[model samples]
Target: MQIFARNLTGRTLTLSCDKSTRIESIKDQIYTADNEDGNGISPPQQRIIYGGRQLCDSRTIEDYNIQQFSTLHVTGSLSGGELVYKFIVVVFSIAFGVPILKYVYRQYVSKLIESATESIANAQKRATERVSGAGRRVTNNRLSGRFK
Candidate 1:
């Protein structure tokens, strides 16, 4: 059976597992799992290499028949129960909490800026009124002294 993994970006990768070999033999190296059963599993990180890099750990190939035509394709994925836990803790946390926190922070900063601007404008208006009043009083005193 051909193995496939679909990424978050909607990309699908086809993995080559020989039809003759039972899934159990390649469980650990090709996929991740808590149990040693032959079911397909996903690993967190895997690199695809033809010749230079070793395809899988020796333990993965123990008692498994890998024929000449049976080439293995390795993929990185989160498999089994660990994958579920990671999805709940990491993915759900970021998906829900980040946007809410960002929105609340943005609103608070905007309100604070608006309040500060209003306070500054009020202070300027009061200073201008006081200065104009003082100037008028001085001019009145000078005129009264001249009249007297």
Candidate 2:
């Protein structure tokens, strides 16, 4: 699969990601993770204060299934006096749009080339026919004049 995006600078962008990914589970793992406040949350099922709200301890994320995998993407931009998350939309759009645009462009170019080739062939055919007819007419005129 292919992906495309328009960068903030109006430049072309491309990104690729595998269909399958592997992620470790939050279980049996230690996290000194800080949330921009010099604070760390560890273990699952722990209640911690976040965004000025009291939340359950479900902060630990873990993957234990040998065949299970997860994807984590992060993107942010500082604008409008706040940061906005735009990673998901960008990733999803590029993941599906690039291939489509590529296919459409290929088809369009193929059609153009076909049309040009056909036009050239027809023109060559007409020119050949005209030359042949003119040759025959000149020969006939010469023969008639000789006979007279």
Candidate 3:
């Protein structure tokens, strides 16, 4: 069957492939064709896509019901290391990000509550001292009033 294959750079080519051909084999062929005589740059790994679905390396054209002249998109696939890095990033963003932010907010709120309570206690102490001082002054005046 004839298939229209396009590389990442939008270069189109027509290739002959049998329905029983594994998708992996087709990728190797394209890679080989791309490097024909080791002349041009080629990607380290590949991802084959057709009909908006990623074609599996172990699957055949017939398995995907790929028709003749169907367009296959060729692009670079992430390496194992890159995939791991991406996974780590996603995991941290979900698992650690929210909790860290919440912890910081909790710290601020706790400090605010503590400061408010301390201020209130200080004000009450001052009020008590003022009342006691006034009572002492009145008592002193009464003691001298008997002499006057």
State every prediction's TM-score relative to the real structure: 0.26, 0.26, 0.50
* Candidate 2 residue pairs in backbone clash: 25-62, 25-63, 26-61, 26-62, 45-57, 46-57
User: Which residue pairs come into collision in candidate 1?
Assistant: 24-38, 43-77
Candidate 1, residues 1-148, lDDT tens digits: the string is 4554333333444455554544444443344432245444344344333334444443332234444444444444444686765566566568776555456568999999999999999997777566434245334235434344
Candidate 2: deviation at residue 64, Å? Answer: 77
Q: In candidate 1, what residue range of length 10 has the lowest lDDT sum? A: 57-66
**How accurate locally, in lDDT, is each candidate?**
0.49, 0.37, 0.76
Writing each residue's lDDT as its tens digit, candidate 3 over 28-136 gives: 7787777765642353377888989989999899999999989999888765696775676567668866555456569989999999999999997777566434245
Clashes of each: 2, 6, 0
Task: Sort the predicted structures by lDDT, highest score first.
Answer: 3, 1, 2
Q: Higher-lDDT candidate among 2 and 3?
A: 3
For model 2, how does the per-residue alpha-carbon lDDT over 15-51 read when each residue is reduced to its tens digit?
A: 3323232112221121222223433233343332323
Better of 1 and 3 by lDDT: 3
Candidate 2 Cα RMSD after full superposition onto the native fold (Å): 19.6
